[model samples]
Target: MRRARTSFGALGAVTSVGVLIALIAACGDDRGGFIKNDRAFETQSEGGAPDAETCLLQCSLDGRSIIDSCTGGVVETCADDLACGAAKCQEPCAAAEADRSSNGCDFYFTQPLSAYPFASCFATFVVNASNKPATVSLELGGEELDVSGALFRAVPNSTDLELLEGPIPPGESAILFVADWDPTIPRSLGERLYHTSCPTAAKPAIQADGYFRSGIGDAFRLKSNVPIGLTWMYPYGGAGTHFPTATLVLPVSAWAKEHVVVNGWEANVGEPVTQIFAAEDDTEITIFGSKDVTNGVGFAGATAGMPAKIMLSKGQFVQIAQSQELTGSLVFSNKPTATVGGSECANLPSKAAACDTLAQQIPAFEQWGSEYVGIGYRPRTANTEEIVWYRMVGGRDGTELEYDPVKPAGAPTTLSAGELVLFRARSNDAFVVRARDAEHPFYLGMHMSGADGEESDSPSHGGMGDPEFVNVVPSGQYMSSYSFYADSSFSEHSLVIVRKKTHGAFKDVWLECAGNLPDWKPIDSAGQYEYRRVDLSRNFGPGDSFGEKRCTTGLQRMRSEGAFSATLWGWGKYASYAYPGGTAFRKLVEIPLSPVN
Candidate 1:
């Protein structure tokens, strides 16, 4: 809901608004009991500004400044056509005004000399706004860019305001300031928040993943072909699904062959597991469950959506019944003395070579299976320091977890038998740390597709066709079609999904990281140059094929008004871009394939 404020004479002398609703009822007379006469009356009183010119400027009913007034104190009002403006003004006006009248919103940043060598830097303001019936335009360093609207609605009398440019409408907020770029690109080193519509208090309860960075360069020069693992720390425990802690004690050999290529690079992955030799104390809790060892029979594990049979499985390999592959890339370092730039890796030498010696690796395939396990934990406290950490268990597959608190002398708790034992992380970092998946003797970075003879300071990144995902277009524009598949085959009667409010000219999208949902970094940091893919597919009930070759109603409602939080994540391989009818395609290949296994 949108809220407006009214003051008496000063901004501090504010009064609360109360809306009084009125209701009326007809009087009825029975027999002749004092039913001689009846009267009707009604009245309404509300704490709102009066509808008059005086009310527009100083609000005669309340004495606050007319916030939405135009030049000459012309009162501006929000009607059906002003929803976006109304929403924008809800809190920003109050907050921006407070900022403008204060000591300023500049931050005190201190960094190592190596990271930022320049002596000093100045803050630049770039505003992009359209006054609608008025005008809007944008300029930088006295140069006019190809902006479409008039640019008059900027700060007029304030120096600080002049330094910061925009007064753009809420709709164009994404383009107000692209980035605080330096004219001279630094040889190396870089770094850089937004308001959440959700209440600040409520956000603490919402679990979030930390945006992890490995700090590896995009190219690697290798002398020998040794197995190097590229990893990003999860920082916490169980994500949407796939618990790792239960699989830890199954022996390291069990996970050696279970490698999977995430974001196009091979990763040695496995689930985290824990075990107990014998019941030690009553404070210890053990969770128990069983495995369904039906050969050649596969069903979807507990994950994000509906359960479907495995599209393909073999020996110990299971595929999600789709053609899209899940993968991540590797970055390489030039300094032989530095392992992946000497951050995550340990071993190093003193030489360098051409950056194309390393080749991308894919995981071997395995037939799917389920298992039962027991879990135990101790009580935890807020003061726990270093209480959360990630370690390697077996394969690249891992589970994020936290240490249980120490129970009293004799109060061990355990879950003995259950279909599945799910664990939840209580702390923010606990949810992301995967001890098993992150297990590696060392870390390394490399360019996956091979090396280009370009300098490290080159402006252009190495590859061009890194598979652009997540492309958001404006309303009424065409969205390319992508493929969709269920884990287990459904007879088509289980569910139906649709995209709502998914239209608009998206300006802040990270297009490079499309398709792979888990690969997406949170859209929080401003200067991060990454993108996420938007999967344009859905499911439906039996006999509900959209067409012989496609699923209908997939991208139809992308622009409707009811849409707000437009989010999509899934996986599949790219098919033909311009297929029949101009639709793009992504197909999930049959699992246990030769290239991956």
Candidate 2:
């Protein structure tokens, strides 16, 4: 027999009187008015406890009051007029409970070791998107981090250290720097002759909690007062000289049973890696390699044109590193899972002077967008135009693509499922991509160019930035507001924004540090949408080297009266990172279930 369960958190607040009236009608009056202690009671009776089943029946009839009273475990307080004698309440009550339990929340990270351990820096920024203040904390391998003192620190210039153990105000954010714990040890006597600090850092433990704990190869469990917007940034690479990247972190509601990783940085220069983390136990996974995966011999012998299989338990992950490109690879699982792909460090155009790490969580095909706006990064110097690389992958065969302001050379007119095309646009160029319709959604990614050997200290270099990868947020997923972070480690930072020209909020859009966004440029002759670039800081060379003293850059907030999309990025000499400001993770497609062998 099924045990009776309380409906405390399962039911949402009742919205209307009509719903209550309808439920009462469904129960009918012929069954008798009220059931008190298993005995019939007068409709006007004010006292006596109602039977559990009967109380639930009345809960559906009187809106929230009686439901709240009964679910609060005070059964005697149930209203007598709720017609608690009904025998038909069990089914609907059970259904409501089942629906609530089905919802889940989990998050994953992809912070692989960089080419040089000393160059690795990982951080996560989270914003309370809800109206209420949010209490946020993190857990790894089942043990919670001491957010109050160990992992979190006060933001840049803010003295409110309490925000670290927040009740962070609505629209505010909490930042976590993994390096705070000191991933490296003090230099030894013998090594002091050759090295200034520890020569190498320790690998993140598979299971542990405390200072020096690495988040690598683990799932991050975020507990918060409400839904949040998250972004992961890995700044500095290659002996702390070059390579940096970032990505928007999708919530568990966006996890799917299938996904296709978009291409990473130039495939020939450095190791291209892909990591898949499971959110459930015994998740069976299959990989259809799009390139000759270098490490294929180990993980089910994955190879180009061949399928590989494996299984992962909750919080466990499998990392695949190779020299070949992993773009177009398909990841399918029996249960929902998350995947992140990129290169440890790569050169743009495959032959650029400097390389940067490229990393972004792959959104499931269900979240692909049918329309996108491509905007390039602001020029490195007032005179030099930055070239941005854009790639689009098809979600369905025969997908037709339309571009405004004249499509560039190499742009495809059509694409087959799992196929992709790459093109280039100048920093000042802004364009729109539209599919035949919502039925032909596609994925879009933007790549930054390398610094081309520009010196960091050159007064005219404008803080030359290197290659980075960022997944473009679809116009369909735009939100009215966003709270993000800009790392001071970078010498310059900026935001690229796109919004409908018809949106009334366009003129009202504002950034926290900067005032109203100005200088909006329309895309081509369409006049349907517009784009703008706002710099948070410009050409400001690195400040204090210590973590706590870097106050020139930190959290940024933006909002509008209507929906809009934005991307946040920052760059230092030979290094850079970029990520979507925020996006809604509505499921846009469905994946058919596959049997596990």
Candidate 3:
């Protein structure tokens, strides 16, 4: 059901392309549907003189110069296979890389900077592996900030707010802030888009948490002088109507242009917020929607509807703001791109519980797996325990779908390609959601109860735990080790949950936060795999950064046998969030099952 992919005409008319996708466009007002992007050609240099043998330079189908044949500069990370050649060599990560735990990495693994779907409030921390001090810079909320004299110790309280307040140190460790920190304001961190709650280098160090608005859908970039490990959180503190606190450990350089579907939060009231980032300049993204449920060009594996087809360019982003329940929309891009989805705040069954914000950057279809263990979360709400719901999207009509431990009667057993379905489980129920045979590979996600909804008619998010979301980790993407931050805010802070992706049990499991994991009690029901919540908050204090742990929350590290899926959960006060656990696993490219010919 994939469309013609891209109009990928040659360069400009002065350029050479097959179809006429305006190499020069005006704000996507042209007929070709290419979003006008001032940054589109950033990665390509001007052409050099052509040799007699051949031009040696050719424009990519997407209308980009493959190798500045004119300048003698080849696109950065082309592979020996020639696959990573011209068309996809839009990123520079191929040239610079840092040490990694896993081996399958490629140019797309480690770069000096990393990109993630943006959120205004996140409890973030970092680790410096450089021997000399490192300076971390941030681009957020419409400002540029830098941190200085950063030192790292294998201990806690390594960072002091006073130290971060300025004449910053070099090569040392400290927590950075770029917020409107006005202690006088009650809705500072949670409600307002003030504190990224993230540890940034420094942007006018001590500022008060400002207005309630935030740059929620903006693309955020973190640049560092040295190879460093960074992690951020949509901590458990809920604001006004923002619900479902979540956490994600991004592989700074691990970005892909192709993503399948990232599900939304709650049901009726939950509007989907989609954020897409172009890794390379002048990149083109043609989004497809299964939710449209149509059959046409660009309608290949989709069914969702939208405004005239949308397009994107380098460094630019597109946000759906708040759209209809598009939890099942599909985005198809010609270049490597990154995506995240959820809601600014949402509730289930419209009248159920309170609201919470949701967000997660998901892997593309090529990276998706067929098996999953469904272990839901228990927020403070609900009478008994918690429930887990699965949003499954198929690629073919009548695709066979099933579950383990049994699903409710009349539950869905089939899916049409591009069809999206949200299936709810009984209270506190846990089960395995898989295809009858594995022919129909689909995507799945989980949700948590936003509020206790006990006796109060009030919407959930108030002092009740807000809704929580985390995509069901596919075993195929599982890694043996990961580097991340563990929130040290003891009260209601961040926790790590680990389980097998399928029937296989994993061994050699280890969690290192500050020190090695002292506890990992087995939890319940994730079907056949390991289930445990590891808490590292006990090892950190206010503004504390364990230098030994690279100044990150607890610098939690994990290693296990067999393929396992792990996720980090944020739960504190009335807010909470969740996201899949991942390593900086590198790859040559993140494309589709079928090449974009």
Q: Which candidate should be chosen as best, given TM-score against the real structure?
A: 2
Best-to-worst ranking by lDDT: 2, 3, 1
Q: Model 2: which residue pairs collide?
A: 243-356
Q: Which portions of model 1 miss their true places by more than 4 Å?
A: 1-166, 173-597
Expressed as tens digits, the lDDT of each residue in 74-138 for candidate 3 is 45434332222123432222211321111111111100000111223223344442223445565
TM of each candidate vs. truth: 0.18, 0.71, 0.61
Model 2 TM-score, all chains together: 0.71
Best by lDDT: 2
Cα lDDT of model 2 by residue, 1-597, tens digit:
111211100001011000000000000011111222211111111111111323322222221122222353423332322222222233222221211111112355535434433323345566554345656566554456554542243346432333254476655665554322122346445433321111123221111112111111334555554445666555322123355567776656557788886757645566776777676777788877777644332245455766677666555455666666677777888898877767767777676657766777777777677778888877777776566788788877778887887786677889887787878777688887778665677889988777773333222333377778878877655544566666555667777888653222244566665556667788856565688777666555422222232324566666653446778777777778787766655444444322223
Please state the error at residue 163 of candidate 3 in Å.
Answer: 4.0
lDDT of model number 1: 0.15
- Candidate 3: lDDT of 491? 32
Clashes of each: 86, 1, 79
lDDT of 1 by residue, 1-597 (tens): 111211111000112100000000000000000011100000000111111221112110011122322132424333322211111221222221121110111111000001111111111111111112212232221123332221112222111111123433321111111111122333233221111111111111111111111110111011101111011100011111110000000101112222222221111121111101110111111111122111111222322122212221011111111111122111111110110010111000101111110111111112111110011111111242211111111111222222223221221122111111212222122111112111211111111111111233211112211111111111111111211111111111111111111111222311111311234222212111122223232222222232233322111111111111121221112100000001100011122212211
